[model samples]
Every structure is written in structure tokens, then in C-alpha cells.
Target: MATGGEAVARLDDGRVIFVQGALADEAVVVEITEAKKRFARGVAVAITERSAHR
Candidate 1:
């Protein structure tokens, strides 16, 4: 989760992952389309665990 309450996560290698169409506290599988030194951009491919809000 991100400080601003966005559905952001971190990879094991310390890469910041921004997930689009993801809900806060939702567990999902993402596909990284772009990778960078500080961050990575991705979209949620599957929601393994849905959030209570959903």
C-alpha cells in the first residue's frame, strides 16, 4: 500500500510497483509492462484476494 492510499506495492528486489485498477488492500497478480531503476508500471491481471470493499 502507498502512503497516499493508492494500491501500490514493492517487489522483492525493492522496485516500487504501481498497480492500476487495483483496490486498496486487495491482493492481486500484476504484469509489469515497464521497468525502471526506481519504479515499475503495471496493471492488475488477477485479483487473488478481493478487498472487503469490493
Candidate 2:
């Protein structure tokens, strides 16, 4: 998780993506909303696997 509360994750290509409304250890399918050189911003389009802690 980030300081801003967005769940931080990495893509298959290793780019960092900040996902909205995601919990720690959750498997989410993200829809990329913004792209940048070092990171990306996205929303969880679908929760592929919900977090057990949630």
C-alpha cells in the first residue's frame, strides 16, 4: 500500500501501478487510466481474487 492509500503493484513488465480501491494481497484486474514513464494509475476493473483480510 502507498502513503496515499492506493495499493501498489507491479505489472508483468515490472512497471509500478497504483490501483484504486484495492486491498493488500488482493488479486485485481486493473484498467489503466493514466500512464507515465516510472509508474501508472489505474482502477480495479475486477477483483480476480478478493483479499482474505478484507
Candidate 3:
């Protein structure tokens, strides 16, 4: 997956998930991240905002 920036999403059950990449910025991998019940939190290793939104 790819994304431009960091993003945090809260599920209906209140689980918080964070991802960093271009896909996340454009909401492309939005549903992919929610497919599993649990996963590791994404750290902004580079911490750069490729997206214009930032």
C-alpha cells in the first residue's frame, strides 16, 4: 500500500488505527486497513507530508 501522510481512523467499535502513506491520504487503502481486526500501528518513519492537504 501507499500513502502520502499520516492518518488515524476510529472504527465503529472505537478501535483506533493509524497509517502513514500516500494511499491513506487519498483514502485508497481506507477499507484495506479495516479488513483485519488487529494490526500494528504505522509510524511515520520519514514523517513527510507528500500530500497537499498537509
Candidate 4:
């Protein structure tokens, strides 16, 4: 998760992934639906770790 409350992650290939409905500092599983040259967009499919803020 990001500082702004959005989930920002990096793939193994170094691609940037963004997810909504996620808490900052939380660990989650995401499913990518769209892929671009620089980044990919997805939603939080599962939350592995709950954040204190959530």
C-alpha cells in the first residue's frame, strides 16, 4: 500500500501495480486486469494482512 491510501506494488518484472480499496502498509493479493507499458491496474482480490488503519 501507498502513503496516499492507494495500493502500489511492484511485480517481479519491476512493473508498477496499482490497486484500490486497499489500506496503506497492508499486504494483499491483487488480480491484474489491465496492463500497460509502465504500469498495471488491478483491484485487491484478497487481503493477507489487515492494516491498523483499516
Candidate 5:
């Protein structure tokens, strides 16, 4: 998790995406809100799988 509770993940091309409303270890479909060279900001559009922690 990030400082503000965003879930951290990596894209297929290896860019880090900070996902809103997602939990660690959970699989989700992301909608990117912002993008930069090394990182991106996104929201979880759909949860493909959920973590037991949630």
C-alpha cells in the first residue's frame, strides 16, 4: 500500500501504477488517471480477484 492507501502495482511494461480503492494482493482492472515516466495513478475499475486480507 501507498501512504494514502492506494494499492501499488506494476504494468506489463513495468511502469508502477498507484491504484485507488484497491487492496494489496488483489487483482483489478485499472483505469489510469495520470501517467508519468516511472509511475502512474489509477483507479480500480473492476476487481478481478480479491485478497483474503479484505
Candidate 6:
């Protein structure tokens, strides 16, 4: 798990992770998929914990 601030992740992974309200900067368990673009978009299937930003 990794924590970052203002992570601008490319939405290529075709997984619908956490929506709004989920914490930011905390690593979350996600199911990711490859999007049309050359990046990975993911959805947080499970939130490991609250992010520091929360």
C-alpha cells in the first residue's frame, strides 16, 4: 500500500474503485482494468484504511 497526495492516476484500468467520500492518499485494495488509453483505472473494492487526507 502506498500513500500519496493529489495522485493524478491515469484512468485506463477499467475498474470502478471507490467513489467520492473515500479517503485519499491511502492505498486501497482495488480491482483494476485496462482502459482504452495506455493507463490503468481502478476501483477500490475495499478500503484498507482512512487516508491521511481524510
Better of 1 and 5 by lDDT: 5
lDDT of 5: 0.95
Structural RMSD, model 5:
0.8
lDDT, candidate 2, 9-51, per-residue tens: 9988889999998999999989999999889999998998999
Over 1-54, each residue of candidate 5 has an lDDT whose tens digit, in order, gives 999999999999899999998999999999999999999999999999999987
- Which regions of candidate 5 deviate over 4 angstroms? none
| Clash totals, every prediction | 0, 0, 7, 0, 0, 10
Task: For residues 1-54, write the lDDT of model 1, one tens digit per residue.
Answer: 655445788888998898886888888999998899999978899999999998
lDDT of 2 at 48: 88
Best by lDDT: 5
Stretches of candidate 1 off by over 4 Å are 1-6
Ordered from best to worst lDDT, the candidate numbers read 5, 2, 1, 4, 3, 6
* Cα RMSDs, all models: 2.3, 0.9, 8.3, 2.2, 0.8, 7.1
The whole-model C-alpha lDDT of candidate 1 against the native structure comes to: 0.85
Q: Which candidate, 3 or 6, has the higher TM-score?
A: 6
Task: Give the winner by lDDT: 2 or 4.
Answer: 2
Task: State every prediction's TM-score relative to the real structure.
Answer: 0.83, 0.89, 0.32, 0.81, 0.92, 0.42
Comparing 1 and 2 on TM-score, the stronger one:
2
Reference-based TM-score, model 2: 0.89
CA lDDT of each prediction against the hidden true structure: 0.85, 0.93, 0.49, 0.83, 0.95, 0.47
Which digits, one per residue and each the tens of the lDDT, describe model 6 over residues 3-48?
A: 4322333333443333332455655665654444344445556777
- TM-score attained by model 6: 0.42
Instruction: Give per-residue CA lDDT, model 3, range 1-54, as digits (tens).
Output: 425444666545666666655334444233343345664355444534355654
Error (Å) of candidate 3 at residue 36 is 12
* lDDT score, candidate 4: 0.83
